[model samples]
Target: MEIKEKITLDMLTKDSVSVLRQKFITLNGEDVQVGGNVRNDFTNCEDDRKILKEQLSEDYYNAVMAVWEV
Candidate 1:
């Protein structure tokens, strides 16, 4: 059984940053790994990971919010 979930900008907008961070870990941790190494420690690039997550969250939030701009 395969259950696929799509995370959209609207979804991110509804969750707190902490929630989003957890979601990012569950869903995107592998995708964000350097060189796709499953054994790599995320802490090795903690600052980079934080920046990437923040950028993604902010980007999604802005995109969704833009829809309501008058």
Candidate 2:
């Protein structure tokens, strides 16, 4: 069976950034790729992939925590 789905993130709020980033990493690793046209603030496909890999790396916890604060 073939299945498709769409998900959106409301990361505009400061408090949600960490959770959003974590969720983004999880979603990016799945079959779905991040999609949207919010040019000014969205992470492109390449960067998204890189970050996803980084999120699973040995330094993931520290890396994610650091980036989450930015």
Candidate 3:
């Protein structure tokens, strides 16, 4: 999957943690595994972020996004 979307809180709501986790890792350039650390990685990514936004509900998405933020 290609990336370059500068991930936003709203950009993460679809893919499973496993998928997102992989993305988080690739974008981060490390295996820190910390949500906050990985989350920042997505900011420089693209395609995947677009795909992730249409999967989860707003509430569920917010909860998931919150994990990466904090």
Q: Which model scores highest in TM-score?
A: 3
Candidates sorted by TM-score, best first: 3, 1, 2
* Per-prediction TM-score: 0.25, 0.22, 0.30
Q: Quick one: RMSD of model 2?
A: 12.7
lDDT (Cα, tens digit) per residue for candidate 3, span 1-70: 2433223343543343432322233444743332432343233224534544575457644666565443
Winner on lDDT between 2 and 3 is 3
Candidate 1's C-alpha lDDT? 0.34
lDDT by residue for model 1 (8-49), tens: 332222222222222222334353212221221222134634
Please state the error at residue 32 of candidate 2 in Å.
Answer: 17
Candidate 2 residues 35-54, lDDT tens each? 43332233424565355455
Q: Give the best candidate by lDDT.
A: 3
Predictions in order: lDDT: 0.34, 0.38, 0.41
Which residue pairs collide in model 2, if any? none
